[model samples]
Target: MKKLINDPKNVVNEAVAGFEVAHADIVRVSHDPVFIVRADAPLHGKVGIVSGGGSGHEPMHGGFVGFGMLDAAVPGPVFTSPTPDPILAATQAVDGGAGVLHIVKNYTGDVLNFETAADLAAADGIQVRTVIINDDVAVKDSLYTAGRRGVAGTILVEKIAGAAAERGDDLDAVTAVAEKVNSHVRTMGVALTPCVVPHAGEPSFTLADDEIEIGIGIHGEPGRERIKLEPADAIVDRLLGPILEDLPFASGDEVLLLVNGMGGTPQIELYIVFRRAAEVLQECGITVTRSLVGNYTTSLEMAGASISVLKLDDELTALWDAPVQTAALRWGR
Candidate 1:
């Protein structure tokens, strides 16, 4: 209930306005329908990469707009999918001669809305491709999605696919890379405390002080189970077990292990989770070649974290190592 804001309904618009000012050098915002585009867009002959969903997941779709990543991002309201008009606008704005790819999460509203936008863009002679991220090993269905909910693994998809596009890969190649990342990645989250929505002015869900919810969604959706709080290592085991089994990531496989915070967890705690995850992977004989630990994707001030593992091949490794300069992720540049 305690949020720093003028009005709940205007939170998205206002927050976006602040973001535009803060990162103006790298991005530009369009207000008519509200989408964020890289300041230098329409790179000729390069495939345009765009991904978006509800707001509140900071440094996600919008924060990722920049060189070697998303050329454009369309953000909806807090935990709500954007309509088609802005998505189409973003697509058109970023399209070069190559084509545009929409990286949608596996949420029903996001899928349907992006589909409508793709159709509209195709009508205007813009080739459009879509990839749906469904890497959550937590659940098969949730309130927001029909299948596994796309969780933190989305960052891996966008980064790898965007690198492919930045290297002048064709539309089909970029789409394939995106799908490959989605297939290789698996994620699961746990929540220690619930977050309050601005409009609702109350917690979306409840957790006792001594309890935790495993396999939580980014939007505070119901997770796999609630149990009395356990040590961080035990929690990491609970999450990593499902993720590893779902992908069956084999021994000798190289991976990019990501320990992501759910907005509120501190870096100290995140590293604890990562430490245990790395230990488990090492025991399994899975090599952790690349590693990322931080708040990449998040719920609105929710106290939790998610661990993602992307089984990496040489090609995927190179793509991840490529230069990237975005608001949230910047490296190799």
Candidate 2:
């Protein structure tokens, strides 16, 4: 791979170091173990919010460390779950006697690791609650496997839950808000090209120059199907159709739309997707009260995009508009 780094194994550590130096005013790096938190965290007695996943999705778990967002973010290797030690440490650091809430994405490793951490924290009398985000509508539900994988909708969950915590809501209230938001959210993604993990040093999967993968998961997993590349409008139509049909939004329903690029896709292309998505929603008689389009969550240099629709009530809408100052997202300043 043509990546600038010291070593593949040390990439996560070095990246954490560089991030701390770059944004020291807003974030603080943990010693030895890899955990990030707001520079001024642990607001006495406020519920701590912790979320994390694999390392390739930068500015995600880490970039979201700051006021009105996550209190601590743990990092794992590329597309791997962080171990229980760092997560437990983060839970301890942010637990201000109120409790700690973990916003974990629905992945096998992530679920296992966070479960272990919760068990560890329970031993120390630190109250811990978890809300797994499974908003991707692409995966089929089965009794044997997880229903759906979490995707970009996680960002919305973190923001809304953090806002609730900042408002002095107890652990139960914060978790309730989190669960509510999780239920209201749905996401779907498509990929034009595959990404190469640094350790693997090769493309995770193969795609022709003109082919695309629909319903792609973030970690280079095979999508539901592969098809020829189409125009931006058609692309948006294909991406949005499944999500809309699955939920079947009603008239006068207010929704928050997120059009996220998968690393390599350009903002201009993302905007095109957003425009088409808005048109499709309006035609369906759904009202999009708020829209955000960009590379919020990303695969490692993959050329693709995902769309997430969050059906919002007044409470969720107010929380969505609340102030946030994370490195990856900033609004209502």
Best by lDDT: 1
**Local accuracy of candidate 1 as per-residue lDDT tens digits, 1-333:** 778899899999998999999999899999989999999998889999999999999989898999999999999999999999999999999999799999999999999999999999999999999999999988888999998899899999999999999998999999999999999999999999999888888998899989999999999999899999999999999999999998899999999999999999999999999999999999999999999999999998999999999999999999999999999999988
List TM-score per model, in order: 0.99, 0.97
Misplaced by over 4 Å in model 2 are 141-145
Off by over 4 Å in 1: none
TM-score of 2: 0.97
| Candidate 1 lowest-lDDT run of ten | 196-205
- Clashes in model 2: which pairs? none
Clashing pairs in 1: none
RMSD (Å) of each candidate, 1 decimal: 0.7, 1.6
Candidates in order have lDDT scores of 0.94, 0.89
